[model samples]
Target: MKKDLVKIIEDALKTLGIEKPTHIEIEIPQNESFGDMATPVAMILAATLKKPPKKIAEELVNAIKDKSVFEKIDIAGPGFINFTFSKKYIYSEIKKLMKDKSKFLREDIGKGKRVQIEFISANPTGPLHLGHGRGAATGAALSNLLEAAGYKVDREYYINDAGKQVRILGLSVFARYQQLLGRDYPFPEEGYRGGYIEEIARVLIKEEGEKYLKRAFDEVSDFFTDYSYKRMLSSIDSDLKDFGIAFDTWQSEKELYKKGDVEKALDDLKNRGLIYEKDGAAWFKSTAFGDDKDRVIIKQDGEYTYFTSDIAYHRQKVEKKYDEIIDIWGADHHGYITRVKAVIEAIGYPKEKLKILLVQMVTLLRGRKPVQMSKRAGKFITLREVIDEVGTDTTKFIFLTRRPDSHLEFDLEAAKAQSSENPVFYVQYANARINSIFAHAREKGIDTDMLYNADLKLLSVHEELRIIRKLLTYPMIFEGAVNAHEPHRITFYLQELSGMFHPYYNKYRVITEKSEQSRARLALCEAIRIVLQDGLEILGISIPEKM
Candidate 1:
């Protein structure tokens, strides 16, 4: 519908022999009394064409004469063109949604673009904490939104399974294992000091049972390193699955080193004169590409930096020929964006094709007080712990209520609430109420098969029309969320729809004495249910049939 309105304005500009702006901005009037859709195209052109906006609006309004599309094209408040769709057109769309909910979904905005979105690639040193949970939910929601918008999206998790971190994890487990075996072994100074390390040691003891007690330290270190990597990675995978997230590919950083992609990336930069050596270190001249200073890709110790592996990973993504590549990282990595983009340009790939979404921190609160520890993880709250506390639906919905880049204070009390105060419950209740209406209709032996025979013109109440109008905005809301890369917008839309619905239901009785009115209203209710389910499904929230 927005597209059709924009096309009409574009056609009007062409008919008048005026060159239009490269992009047109269309808006929904904040005050619904104004119109269904409004645009300031006339006002925008007024400054460019040196004419009064009202006069330009008049010309554009005169150019559009299709009464079927617009009930009225009025020039309102200085220059804005407000288009109120014909009642027939509005009813037609509602019928379409009821007939086939998929028809209301936006079509192919991405045009089958192959997109790779890599997210939640936490190092396999520990369980996924709340920070990682936010990334998982955000990334999964984004992948769903992109696929709905017609992009071929690959959901990937990059495992940082190589380097000092994994070795330290192994040492931590080994130290704990030695302690468990009554050996006085000093733990590594920089080893991981979490209870999880002790847990890994216990599991290893149960399995190996003193077999490694007298082994060489080198052999033990090697065994523990590989063992810890596999065990911790398995835990991370289990946590993600319990939190309702799955990845299409689990790319390993270890594999990058084994396949020599890291060296190849650095060598490519060197051949392009993008790298220089200083202080026995191989450095990339990132400052030339707008970085604050040069960065070391290879250290004096002859080991590749994390930045080098990241460049190689991204270069591998480039080689895969994706039209767009997206990385969802924690907010602390904001400074890393500049150098990563520079490397993309250094590697001769379009920097514009790469998008990095930084997910902010989350603080869990219970009522007015901050809840510090996870009962299950015994340290910071794990993603799985939160899911177990409040099912997957509430976890995902609350995670998305705020923007991914904004700090979220998740309230435990509020999330589990069954009242209207809880946005998740409120939206789900609306869907459940619609279902109840249909279920009641069936119990009353009302033949819903003849719903199409009802006269839609009977839905003349102002509230009924408002509900239909809000339902029609689903596609627009979906497309806007896809374009902005923010799925939080959908949650807001569902809340608004539910807000409009509850009052409308209370004001009007759907199962009326008049059979025609009852059927039309029920059909309208069905349309609302379909849209509610569609939006919730995209957010990975389930819609229950009963409250």
Candidate 2:
């Protein structure tokens, strides 16, 4: 419908011999009384035409040939053209929605572009924390939105299994194991002291029965690292899966090092003259590609840095032929983006093809009180713990209520509440209410499946029209969220839609004896249900029919 109006405006500009702009801005008025849709194209053209905006608006309005679908077109304050939908058009759209809900679904704007998104690739040193949970939820939701917009999207998790962190994890577990055997071993001061590490030690003792206790630290470190890496990664995978996130690929940093991919990446950079020796270390000239300074790819000790592995992983993604790559990292990794992006440019890949989303920190709350967390103290909450305390749906929904770059305060009390204060509850309740309406209609022998025969014109009430208009905005919301890479926009849209629905449901009944009117309204309710279900599914939240 917006497309249709934009075309009409474009035709008016063309007929008037006025050059059309590259893009037209159409907006819905804040106060619906202004109109169903509004445009500022005439004002946008006023400066170029050297004419008063009001005069240009009037001229543009007069040039539009088909005003039958609009009840009226008027130039409002500041030369904005406001359009009100005629009753006939609204009824037609409602009937179309009833016949086929897909009409409201957005088009395939992506046009088969292949996109690879790697997210929540936390090191398998410990269980996933709240920060990892946010990345997982946001990445999963963004992937779904892109798929809905017709992109061939592949989700991935990059494992940092072959790093110093894993070595520390091995040392931590080894210390715990020695303590279990009553042998004194000083744990590294910076070693991981999480309770989960102790659990791993206990399991290893049970399986091997102190067989590795007498082995030298160097000999047992590899075994402990490999054993703990696999177990911790398995735990991370299980938590993510239970949270409704599944990755298409699990790329291992260990595999990259084993295959010499990191060295290959460095050699490629050296060939391009992007690699330089600085202070006995190999550095990449990242500053030439907008980084603040050159970044060291290898230390003086002949060890590859984490950045070296990351660059290689990104190069691998490019070689895989994905049209676009998206990396979701924690806020602490913000400085890494410029250097990684520089690597892409140094490799002659289009910098625009790679995008990074930095997920900010999450502050958990109980009511209004902040939940304290410390990684070193082993007091931080795990993602699995949050999911266990509150169901997966609640966790996912709350995680996305804020933009990826914004600080999120997820209140436990609000998430568990059953009122409108809780968005998941509110939205799900609306869906459940719609289902109950359909059930009542069914019990009363009202055939909801045959709503096609009902007269949709009976839905002329203001609230009904408002809902119909709101439903028409689904595709717009979908497109906006996908293009902006913000799934929280959909959550906001669903919340507003629920705000509209609860009022309508309370004021009017959908199971009246007026069979045709009831059927039309029931069809409308079902349309709302379909849209709610679609939006919730994109956010990876389930719809409970009886919630």
Candidate 3:
């Protein structure tokens, strides 16, 4: 409906002999007094036409004399033109929603293009911490949003199993293994010290038997590291699945090394004159493409750096024929974005084809104080622990309540509290309440069959109009989320929309006073229920039929 109104305004401007602007932006007014829909096109064009904004707005108002759909048009503060559509039009929109609720909100802008979103990609050094959980929730929701927008989307988690971190994890586990066998060994200070390391060591000891303990420490460490890396990856995968995140691909860095892609990537860069030796180390000339300094791809010890494997992984993504690639990384890695884009540019791919989303850190809070997270002290919170304390839905929703680039505070008390204070419960309660209305309507023999046959023109209450107006905003919300590549916007939208419904329910009764008005309002309620269900489903949140 908003798009339709914009077209009408554009045509009205052309018909009035006022040169139509090249573009126009239409938005819902923040203040209800402004009107249902507002536009600043006249103010934007006044400078070019050498006319005052109000005068231009007057001309626009006069040009759009067709009062068929619009009930009123007013020029408010600063030449803002606001339009209030007729209640009849509002009813018509509700009817349209009732007729085509399933397909009303989705758009075909992506046209089935292949897009891969890789996120969290945390090394299997320890259990996933609070930060990894944030990335997982954000990436999973993003993949669902892209699919809703008509794209063929793939959610992927890259396991960093062939890195220094995995080696550290192995040493950490081997240290525990030897200690269990009554041997004294000094663990590396940089090695992982999480309590889970002991569990991994115990498992390895049980599986490999005592014969393996007789081997040299270095040999045992090598065997344990390989074994621990694979086991940790499996555990991470299972935890993510339990958290309602399922990845379509589990790409491994070890697989890249095994397939010789890492060596090939280095050779290609060297042949292209993009790599050179300096200080007995091979460095990539990333500065040629806007990096602050040339980065060493291979160190003096003849070992490949993390950046070497990353370049090969990106090349592998491009080889898979993905039209676009999105990488979700922590905010601490913001500086790496430039270098990664530089590598893509050097590899003959447009910089725009690859996009990096940096997610800010999440701070767990108990009230006013920040919860300390330290892996070395063995006092960090894992993603599994958060889910164990709060269910998956609450955990996922809280993680997505804030923007990916902003600091988030996860309060365990607030999330677990089963009251209106919990945003997830509030939203879910709205869905449940809507479903409850349908059950009551069924008991009263007031189903869709009866409502469809009744006159919908009777839905003229102010609360009914407001609910319909909020329902009409779904398409705009969907479009904004897709354009911004931000799934948290949907979470915020659901909260607001659900808040609107709760008040509407409190003020008016859906199944009371069996008049034509009651039937019409019930129809409106049904439409809202469908939309709420659809929106929550897109975010991977369950809409319970009952609380």
Query: In lDDT terms, which candidate is top?
Result: 2
Residue 499, model 1: Cα distance from true site in angstroms = 1.0
Candidate 1 per-residue lDDT, tens place, 1-547, comes to 7777788888888888889898888888999999899999889999889999999999888877565778887899989999899899988877876776766666568999999999999988888877888898899999998998899999999988888888888988898898999998987777877788999999999999998885656787878999998999999988887777889999999899999998898789889999888999989999988899999988999898888899999889988999999999999899999999998899887788789999998888888579887523436766777788777777888888889978998877766663345678889999999889888887877667746456888989999999898888888888899999999999999999999999989999888778778888888887788888888888878788898
RMSD of each: 2.3, 1.6, 2.0
The residue ranges of model 3 lying beyond 4 angstroms of the native Cα positions read 17-22, 220-222, 417-420, 449-454, 513-515
> Candidate 1 overall Cα lDDT vs. reference?
0.86
Compared with the true structure, model 3 gives a TM-score of 0.95
Clashes of each: 0, 0, 0
Q: Model 2: per-residue lDDT, tens digit, 1-547?
A: 6877989999999999999999898887888889888999888999999999999999999999988999999899999999988878877776666577654565578899999999999999999988899999999999998988889999999999997999989989989999899888887898998999999999999998888886777987889999988889999989987998999999999999899998898899989998888899998999999999898888999898999898999999998999889999999999888899998998998888799999998888888899888777678889888888878887888888888998888887767763355678889999999998889888999988857567878888999999988887687778778889999999999999999999999999988989889988987897788889889988998889897
Cα lDDT, model 1, residue 82: 93
| Inter-residue clash pairs, candidate 2 | none
Q: lDDT rank, highest first?
A: 2, 1, 3
Query: Considering only N, C-alpha and C atoms within 3 Å, which residue pairs clash in candidate 3?
Result: none
Q: What's the TM-score of each model vs. the native? A: 0.95, 0.97, 0.95
Candidate 2 Cα RMSD (Å): 1.6
lDDT of each: 0.86, 0.88, 0.84
